[model samples]
Target chain A: MTLNLEPLWLTLKLASLTTFVLLVIGTPIAWWLSQTRSRMKQVVATLVALPLVLPPTVLGFYLLLLLGPAGPIGKLTEALGLGTLPFTFPGLVVGSVIYSLPFLVQPAHNAFEAIGSRPLEVAATLRASPLDRFFSVALPLALPGLLSGGILAFAHTVGEFGVILMIGGNIPGETKVLSIAIYDHVESLEWTQAHWLAGGMVLFAFLVVLSMNLLGQRMRQIGQD
Target chain B: MIELDVAFRLDRGNFTLDVAFTAPGLGITGLFGRSGCGKTSILRCVAGLERAAGHCRLDGETWQDDAKGIFLKTHRRPIGYVFQEASLFAHLSVRDNLKYGMRRVPASEHQIAFDEVVDLLGIRQHLERAPSGLSGGERQRVSIARALLTSPRLLLMDEPLSALDHASKQDILPYLERLHDTLRIPVLYVSHAPDEVARLADRIVLMRDGQVQAIGSATEILSRLDLPLAQDTEASALIEGRVQSHDDNYDLTRVAIPGGTLTVGRLDQATESRIRLRIHARDVSIAIRKPETSSILNVLPARIVEMQEIDRSHLLVKLCTAGEPHPPLLARITRYSRDRLKLEPGQEVFAQVKAVALMD
Candidate 1:
């Protein structure tokens, strides 16, 4: 049988969209977590890291409730003419973003913290305003961490299965991502198709991990020089 | 004048810093103190890096005044600070690091040209290299050049050379001296090294236990017997003099101090050009009468001003030239010599200096 290939394409699309959205929103949150001296820092950090420890189904279940027709957010969206989000492509994007948030935030926060206060102070004495220093000094110094965070977030989103099943129910082009499609094939005893998809996933995971290690080494070498 | 009246307490440790002093706005004013004496904290306050409550006025501009509710942030203050470490941006090339501040400053406020500072700091050759590849001295020189390119009105240096090795410090000191001799900006240099202060500062603000002990001209402050400097083993006296003559035959230069001439090692300076001399107290010997012939070249008649017992074995003798107005000199002599020579506050004697260091 000819492979449909629709699930693979949809998986890539969802991971890409999720990674992009997470980076845009995660950066400031990570920066705040790194620099803040407030008592609320730990609470905020724990919330961001909840997906790493809690089962993906738990997060997906809560998200489904929040985005379903009877939920507060769903009702508000309906009133604004956007309708409810559950079982839609946008709903899948939202679930993936939350599932992979800690993957993006932890590295970026660590990178920012490793910079210490000296460079910023030096920049200030040199007449660089706070915004200027943040862009010129802090951003460049933290680029390696951000890049790694983005890659991890993308890979983790690609591998996610339970969250999408719960909030983005298996709708053909909208929500039938690679992992769910593999499960469907196996349940129907379509062993050849299942083998092809599972083998592709293993290769993809290996490549992602290998690239991350190589990139990390390259960054470390540049830092040393 | 640069007026600083600041008081603050640190939370990490039970340290309270309270100091007030006014220094001339034209030269390097050394903040001399021991480690943990809050010298760096005072510099931070002046730079607006620390949130200390007080008034800091540079010339006529008020940078901070708690009572008036006016506090300029560090970036708003026209100041350059060189930290103990070079603190160059690791990601930027040396050239970019030097340009970082210059680009932020408005064109009209750019009094210090980029090339001028690079040349002044002798970092023209390493501009394209990354900070991580540079030696400690090179990094510090780049940092100094970066600060200068901002065209700051006041420069704050917090133990800038303390992190360097001895050889690196030696390599960087001449550049500092050049900066002092050429630059017009007022500088506040904080350092625990007495030699660095003696070499660079025109005025000295001595600090002890987070308090301002004294503020005076370097010559007056370094020689004061009442201060802790005179009691240390490295105690020395600073004397300002003019070049009188060069003895080409012996490769020696005769400098005319307040009361007498001192024949020191040959100097490159022209006749009548001013110079500074550093005579260590340990290198000075007292004689009841002037020797007719001796290897020591500097022997001038002086009267004992006061004496303090540094220990049971040693005495720090404060003396002034017998006939003319001169900065007092300190001599650390054995108590046995003081007894043998019957040295007293008003007694006349000769001070034989074994070694005299010529400082510019």
Candidate 2:
């Protein structure tokens, strides 16, 4: 019920870090989805977007078991001297990354789809290796998609309460992100504290969306030529 | 010597592309065919853009062979392909588009100089601009220059000017002419337009339905009356000549054909330039004697080599000229004109050229 800024800052920090990590992993997946034709591509595509459509409650329930002391991931980490993953900030990051995955992937898929095969072909003839082509031509052209995906992932992760509560267990500084903090205020009938935290989140989300729209317009203009 | 015994099979619906050809070394060998005739597929196969069953050997180098397990990747093949569109990188400037190819080739072995290509294509002014800003003709010029900079053993161009309007095609043609003259590397030019083949190709490979229908000098196959395309309006004898002189004042350039000299609009080109002239079959009329009074400047006394009915109404007559030793000039006259003149096989006649289109 008390006004505490730590949970909000931790949530923001977690969302930012998770978004950065997801962009690295999501970029290649998006590019492959745009280019690959193999039978495995279908399976990979389904798996990447699976976390988006699956019920978050059910996924969180399963994650609770998977990261528990007796679970395989927990035991593996404990044996490796890292201890358990549950009730931790890193655990919330892992949960948020899985929950907000489709946000990162879909925008990038659309971006990669918009680029023509011409620049890549020109690159090949010019003696650019495939890696060079990806870095020099595909990555630069697909930047807008990446930017939008990263923003969506970060905003969605910041607002996530269900998965974080189920696995992270509302541990104060370690796991109580802003959304969990607002929910705690509501549970205790602390209207004033909830209003301030919720209002800040609303303002942050608006700015992100507005800036994202501008970024998309700039990217679309660059893509047109 | 550049040798190609390449054959590839491609299936598209009911249409199957089964093409094979062997090209002589040097200059340009045109892959001539109609739409959907697998001309582009053949070029793609040569460039390793498409995989085919057949093997290709160029100057004893293996580009593809299913049995030998040698199929170079598209990027690994030392080839330059100019697609129907310029296909230039829209994001890169013209200079970068050119650099795409040049940078790939090692500096020690690169035969094409950067400045030379820029000058050759007349793209120096446009180098800083992106491909989107360039005109269709300008884009194509850059495409040609990009391909040239690759230092390819074989260059493949698939209908590079098909997207352009007539004015653009005209503007792009002279650059191709210059490229054909300066580059000793073999080029495979794919087009359905007979005029393009006549203008630039030293040798023509006529393809019909995924098969090699005819292969010889551009003049020989073009003059044949039996082929469906020979009945076309542009169908004529392709006469090879050396630029004897160009008169600026009169606005005419004289070219010495086998039987006699022909002149057309003056060309600003080097003297002794090899040029091809398309003498329309409909333009030539048969005469038993040299006419004393006539407007046509090109009239050569010749013997009829052969005659065949191209269709119900058109008759194709072949005439032997003095300078052209290999191929004969074909004159397509109406059957009505043929019966009236009593023009028969092996008959001596005076051939009058109505018009001649000189090609660089």
User: In order of the candidates, what TM-score does chain B achieve?
Assistant: 0.96, 0.92
Report the lDDT tens digits of candidate 1 across residue range A1-225. Answer: 989899999999999999999989998899899889999999999999999998989999999899899899999989999888999999899889889999999999998998899989999998888888888888899999999999999999999999999998889999999999999999999999999999999999999999899989988887666
**lDDT (C-alpha, whole model) for all candidates:** 0.89, 0.84
The CAPRI category of model 1 is: high
Q: What DockQ number belongs to candidate 1? A: 0.84
RMSD of each: 1.6, 2.4
Worst 10 residues of 2 chain A by lDDT: A118-127
lDDT of 2 at B317: 88
Q: For candidate 1, write residues B136-177 as lDDT tens digits.
A: 999999989898989998888999999999999999999999
Residues A179-210, candidate 2, lDDT per residue (tens digit)? 88888899989999999999999999999999
Evaluate candidate 2 and give its CAPRI docking class based on DockQ. medium
